[model samples]
Target: MYFFLINLSILDIGAISVTVPKSMTNSLMNTRSISYTGCVTQVFFLIFFVGTDFFLLTVMAYDQYVAICQPLHHERVMNRTACVQMAAGSWASGVLNSALHTGNTFAVSFCRGNKVDQFFCEIPQLLKLTCSDSYLSETGVILFSVSLALCCFVFIIVSYIQIISTMLRIPSEQGQHKAFSTCLPHLTVLSLLVCTAWFAYLKPLSSTTSQLDLVVSILCCLQ
Candidate 1:
């Protein structure tokens, strides 16, 4: 649990740092410009950390599943070696996904003005600036991301179902309460994270930016 928590903390820091620092500096300096290279780097790390957060949340769900549903085997199932491997795998996957997105996005010709409406260089906003049909490649990336997120969402749902079923069979009110107390907050947080991400990225793109876009962008930045 500690290992997973530490990794999650690191992921959160990386994710927030990617955009917040530059956004803050821009605000303080009263400027709203980032170099093309810097924008690309931000896009890459932002995707990386967001992907890592998704995987880490899934992992933590699995950890809670084991702890609540199969308490006797919790230590063995979530051992140090397993924790390290999961953390490494999450980071590795994040990097790969981010690389694919960054490469595809930057390959397009940016004929449109580079003024991103959002405070940061979000992929959707960047896509808006592309002048070529090659932007379809980035659309493919979004589709792939949605598919992956759906799979993880399904996994977490199944794990929670099993967890709930196990808790119900515990026979003691206090025991059930204890079990739920541990899992409910995790479930709530995961739901908020996944739903916000899906809504932000999977929704139909508008030709003109709407108020909803800004709201969704702000929601995505929230902790």
Candidate 2:
């Protein structure tokens, strides 16, 4: 748990550090700006850390699920080997997915319009700002994003379902309360995260009006 928490802290720092300071600097200077290389680097690293965070949260959910719903077999199920494998898989997937997205994003050229709408170089925002043709790149980005989102969503749903089923089997109200208490924090955080992510990225791609953009922009900054 300590190791996992430390790594999670690092992931959180990486995710925010990639964009926040730069965004702040731009804001202070009264400029909406990023260099080509800087933008690409930020985009790649941001994707990597975000994917890592997703997998970490999913793994944590599974860990809680096993510890709660399968207490009798938890020891054997989440032994040292299994724990190591889960961590490795999450990190490896993040690296590979980020590389793929970065490559695809770079394949789209920017002829003139280099201004990204959001502070960070969001794939959708950058693509829209690019004067170059980006049908293929945009399609690829959508596919990758959807795949990751669906995978995480399914795992979380399954985890919660199993959790609820197991909780329902408890005979006493006290037992049920104790069980639910352990998972409530995770559920709350996951709900907030999913809602915010959907609102930020899954909204209409063509709906980047100034007011809506500022609201989402502030949320992103706060996050």
- lDDT top scorer: 1
Provide the overall lDDT of each model, using Cα atoms, as 2-decimal numbers. 0.86, 0.78
RMSD over all Cα atoms, model 2: 2.2
For model 2, what is the C-alpha lDDT against the true structure?
A: 0.78
Q: How do all models score by TM-score?
A: 0.95, 0.88
Model 2 TM-score relative to the real fold: 0.88
Model 1 lDDT per residue over 129-199, tens place: 88868699889987898788789888999999999999989999999999999888777768777777777
**Per-residue lDDT value at 132 in model 2:** 49
Instruction: Residues 6-76, candidate 2: write the lDDT tens digits.
Output: 66778878888998899889889998878889988998998888777778779888988998888999889
Ten contiguous residues minimizing lDDT sum, candidate 1: 214-223
The parts of candidate 1 lying over 4 Å away from their true place are: none
